[model samples]
Target: VFALVFAVSCENSNVKEEPKKEEFRPLIVRKDGQYIEYYPGHKQIKMKGREDADGNRAGIWKLFSQDGVELSITVYTKGKKDGHIVVRYPNGMPNYVGEYVMDERVGEWKFYAETGELLETIVYDEPTKENK
Candidate 1:
């Protein structure tokens, strides 16, 4: 009976516990016309952006990685992605730079290596009817 109880306790101890879920609080409104979001426990800034009076995303929006590094910067117009969109590596180096016109990718999109070297440039063509 002693051996059986010890084995049961050992089995329970070996079971992995589920990770606790992190709860995200609401965006803190800033007087500068931007909204800021924070991480659950640390309360570190996760994102900062502005929205139109209609609650649509407008102007430049920046999203951060969990480590608090800027992950991407997207330009929005009236709720659609427009103008330049820049995504960065965790180290804050530009990973990709592309342009969007009225929500569709236009012109050349440049991709970079993690070391900040330009890898390739992909030119986007107008969407054909079949491709659309």
Candidate 2:
């Protein structure tokens, strides 16, 4: 988990604020550790993940709604999505679950209904004769 430390400042807000101009949102700032993004004008974590020293995504990243419901989860390797990802409905039901290899979807992917019934299955990568 990323410990909130520094206050992020918007890169575009370096100039003096003009009364007529719209305010800019803060930019994400990090220092070779977990990254946590807060909701605009709020303190709740909108997204959180860890990154390598060079800024490459290193592990699982999770996104949440403003009220703290998990929206989706994805695993990354060197900034590329390389594992399972599950996206959920607003009510927190799993909408779809699939796997990724090197940022590409692979194997069987399943979609479900809000009632928790399987709706469909799609094979992203068919088995080859050698693998069969």
Candidate 3:
């Protein structure tokens, strides 16, 4: 009957709509080799990660700038950074090279001059200590 059909449609309409899922955020390559989202993005941005068959980040990741420049190339192992991580200047010269442990600077770091010369070396024996 029309009444039965109307009642059924009304009940269906009363069903709650599913909540929208949160957008995928970019993974922050931590020194512990874990990929966690450290920041949020507004648009659909491409991301890269070293993933195992289980789809967890297990190695290096290279994140690109929205303009397609290599923004940062980071290392990871079992989701932790354990090796050289390099970031470049817009012109592609070395911006930073250093070691990390659990996302903290824990070793020697060298900076290069814009002219491509070694600028300085900083040795970190402790997170709060620096020897230049």
lDDT by residue (tens digit), candidate 3, 51-92: 665556567787665555676778766566766788777667
Best by lDDT: 1
Tell me the TM-score of each prediction against the true structure.
0.67, 0.70, 0.50
lDDT of 2 by residue, 1-132 (tens): 133322234444566765796567564646559888888775578988999878888799999999899999999999888889999987899999988887777888899998778999989765322131
Model 2 misplaced regions, further than 4 Å: 1-27, 126-132
lDDT of each: 0.84, 0.81, 0.67
lDDT of 1 by residue, 1-132 (tens): 999999999999999999998775555655456677777655578888898887778999999988888899999988888889999999999999998876888888999999999999988888322134
Off by over 4 Å in 3: 1-46, 52-56, 127-132
Order by TM-score, highest first: 2, 1, 3
